[model samples]
Target chain A: MGNQRDSIGDSSAHNIYLTNGASEGVRQVLNMAIRSKEDGIMVPIPQYPLYSALITLQGGTMVPYYLDEPKNWGLDIKDLEYRVKKAKDEGLNVRSMVVINPGNPTGQVLTEQNIREIILCYENSILIMADEVYKNVYSEGSQFLSFRKVLNGMGAPYKDNELISFHSISKGLMGECGLRGGYMETHNIDPFVEEMFYKLKSIELCSNTIGQLGTLLMINPPKRGVEADEVVDLYEKEQGEIYGGLKERAKMLTATFNKMERTSCSEIQGAMYGFPRIHLTQSAIKAAKEQGVQPDFFYCMQMVNETGIMTVPGSGFGQRDGEFHYRITNLVSPTSEMRATLDRLEAFNSEFYAKYSQ
Target chain B: MGNQRDSIGDSSAHNIYLTNGASEGVRQVLNMAIRSKEDGIMVPIPQYPLYSALITLQGGTMVPYYLDEPKNWGLDIKDLEYRVKKAKDEGLNVRSMVVINPGNPTGQVLTEQNIREIILCYENSILIMADEVYKNVYSEGSQFLSFRKVLNGMGAPYKDNELISFHSISKGLMGECGLRGGYMETHNIDPFVEEMFYKLKSIELCSNTIGQLGTLLMINPPKRGVEADEVVDLYEKEQGEIYGGLKERAKMLTATFNKMERTSCSEIQGAMYGFPRIHLTQSAIKAAKEQGVQPDFFYCMQMVNETGIMTVPGSGFGQRDGEFHYRITNLVSPTSEMRATLDRLEAFNSEFYAKYSQ
Candidate 1:
């Protein structure tokens, strides 16, 4: 749990709070900050719907800023500023921003420069709730950097910025999500806000004690050459294969989608999913409206109907208006299954597009 | 999962919704039914803090109906009706009622007739959220009865009552709280309400899959004469010992608390706790007020400070005006430790009372 603290040079363990999972931590932070309709949080467009769902559940307005899907799904500082101002103009009192690194659905690892800019962007009143569950899953060219690390490195007021960042054993090499284990560490939060977090968790009776123990074992695994050499070797070997396989499959899928006549996919820089934008024909859009569903949803439903494959529509995850994309995981097992999915997807794309393209 | 379900004789499993734990199910039901300050839920006074905490978190007004502590903490029907009318008069739209049977903190199990009457008392609009996690742990004279069973047993309008009753592997014979597993079954819920439940759960990406699977195994254990017959016998043997031990301990603690000079404890009809109301002196109340805390809180904190004993304050669980009590779990491990706790509590009571006698 102190792993994040070590990364950012925290002097004490007081900052870390173990949660039911990353989601619970996220809920607590959002719940603590957003007290009424006036409060809102900025979320990345095409985000993990958990963000949108939780915001709605907590009655907080979700102000979305579009990611630069054209540029490997990079953060667009200008777009985010526009969203903040736009939301304020609409009578929303925006208090926080949520940044998912190695983004869910988007699968983009943010640059260190981008992170620093995000911290410098928000005022002291706005807390940063960073969803870094996929921090350990970056692509080859990108390295996972903590918002805390970036903020601390910048020095001064940036170092003391209010930030609640999270990590999970559910993701990463461990993949023990079934156990529901995760931790959140805050950076320089006010004592009042800190007390509320404690009070909230005390009510949940401390988020399943076993999950916290599972996290402890994960963060402090048995040392190599200290009576666990064989275990360590096995862990390293399996972890290498999983990551290497994910990166390879992600690349294969993105390339395949890009090659399709009416589709383009941003690079899968990290995380498990690839979000591929589909160029829906006018007739397909018309057909979707007749069926009373979003175009991307209709497209995904068609693929599922034909090839027995399921993908989530962009609309379900909050996307830019008039754009259609679907999110698919790069985690298809038995390698051959992955190849077959791609083959079926390629065939379905051409066949379906030809039917409606004219 | 199929247990409260069996109580209602549901041919389909549509009613059952597995949750992260019983708390999650309870949270979801309350969240779905109560959307604003105009919405309120009738909760038992001296109830589980989880109900109070969750209702407060969701911004739902808690209309507390006092229990008859002298009558084995019996549900006072007239009192509940009065509370409901009062809340309505105050402009709160009370839409649901929470029943923590084998009550938490109170530890009183309602009879089947009581359960049926509760359903009849509420209009069609008021949903019933039954916290039956302790349904299987009734005292010798009491029998655990599901709200679903009572409702259906009456037939017609009663059979179609909107009810969400919870059960957990964390309680009963399994005692797997740290693993966090439970299920909630809805009886004759409107399709719209059912859709809302599904939508809300979909956001959390399905509660701890392992917990749900744990529940599935718990509900469908192997037959006695099956291939795993020996394992089944062993399980029964262990389970019997656990139950036998709990019953004995609960009996011993209730008697002990009653024997104390200034304390009286209601029967532990179900659940794990023995909530003992302590008669405090005027001086003690004054001292507590001087410290700026609830008298019960101050009393419990003093006990902790002096004797290293921790118990939940009655005020935390919502007690009658000016009454002081604290809750202690009867599930203490090791017979000797339980005895020591009892002995220490007895001696501390007299010593502490003498100090504040003036």
Candidate 2:
């Protein structure tokens, strides 16, 4: 599946482990790395809950670094360095750093330079967990750059930095989330740790056969000359349509969110979500506190009740203290359907603001 | 899926949780119930390794109660009670007991009397985990009796005993192991504990959609009038043939092992395996000790090397110290093929005895 032109160089079969889903792979890595509360995992604030949840489940310390939402949800090397240093100061052994490129919720694709800087910052101090499941789902100008590719491009010591990159058939064009097909590729990971991973995986016997087969087809789709020309053509056409539709939906969702009052959304550069920061009035916050829930959760619940538009409250995924945000997917199909949903959301936001402005 | 005619009573939908496989359900329960080393889980010796492995992973104390080999691998209530008492005396909380019925590897079906005695022994002190994946795979004159049924029959106090009964499409006549489909039914479990289970399961989203659907079909197969009669007839015929073939193989395997020199196998009343105790000579034991491996492992390895037939060492499943045993599955298809394999086993066993007897 690697392409030299894209700088995603070769990966050996021995280093790859097929999992039920990217979540399973993520869980295994967290479980392997975290031994106690002393072991810390560096995660992004307003992150996918899987990382935080798994860390808590494994009894590990979460050393969170806030993503720069003002900078279109970009990674700040200084913020990461600060978090790691602070965690270390607290007597935590920060074992791993999780980087969700083409970020979940905050869907900004990382630049190659950003990736290189993060690699240099962590070096060999922590294992890099690269969650690049949305590698194929990028906005027009924001191309996906894999951590393995960036690390490989760097020479000697940097190249030897341990990294585990995850990909999923559930994301990208396949959208086979229900099938639970994904894989993790280990790069420069210690041989002993790799063996431990294999041992842990073998405890479950194997991933479901259907999911494994789906992963195979995803990574190695029909090639032009290797298969019937018509079959290859149909495959390419369908894949292109899916990608194009996703790109269009992402753009429309971002535009719609930006247009809403008291709400600001970073560009949906990649992945399926658009996490918009909502500016709730003091009364709304007070009302939410009275109800014993986060403001974002209250807003989301209200939206759901009023318009039947479900959203994930940003509190579920750890956000900065007192900040209100909600994650909405661009996956509502038929383009027109998504447009209608956005229209309802905009109307709801206006009514909410008017009701609570006093 | 419950049939009152066979003493398998009705189950509510709210109580059932679909899993990737019976293994996953077992892992979840172990994870939920085991909080610390002071929490003890009672597991049968000569048990399926899944229980032992999960208990160890969860860092819980494994209080083993050995099943009687001489009495056809029957559960002894006194043995269980003794183990529980010993664990409790050691300052451990005896949390749960695992009963693999229509036993794995041991292949014995529990009598209704035995099941009732077990329920009375533990009562409200420990939760019962019934691994009933092999409930349908029984020999002639042997019946699969669920612990749920026996407990319900015992009236109020026994019916209120907490139990989690697991069933799998991977076992029984389905044998869809690779598809990874199973479900666990919670009976009289604490509402709060059940809620915690739901929360734990939600971390992985849901089991694979395909596996869940497979489990649905397994529990609710087409009825004669509900679907085409031909389809129902075909399903019944195939299921019957598979069951009949397994029963025949189980009987044949038991007979062959009993006839072999210095080996004794109990009746294969149910389940898919034959656990035969191999009488390894002193010289053989000495040789195995020198090689730093269990005697049964050494014997199984030699058998594999000579005959290309693989069997799991009894040591893997836990057994009495100094006892040599191995678990061989009666899953080889076609009566003639199973017969040939048995002949090979007999020949290899004789040769092994002759070489090591001195």
DockQ for each model: 0.53, 0.75
Clashes (backbone N, CA, C under 3 Å), per candidate, total 0, 0
Candidate 1 lDDT over A66-142, as tens digits, reads 88887788888888778888988999998899999879989999988888878777665578888888745546778
Model 2: pairs clashing at backbone N, Cα or C within 3 Å = none
| TM-score top scorer | 2
Scoring only the A-chain of each prediction against the true A-chain gives TM-scores of 0.94, 0.96
- Scored against the true structure, residue A214 in model 2 reaches a CA lDDT of 87
Kindly list the per-residue Cα lDDT of model 1 for residues B181-223, writing each as its tens digit: 8888877788987888888877775567667778887777656
Score residue B97 of candidate 2 by CA lDDT.
90
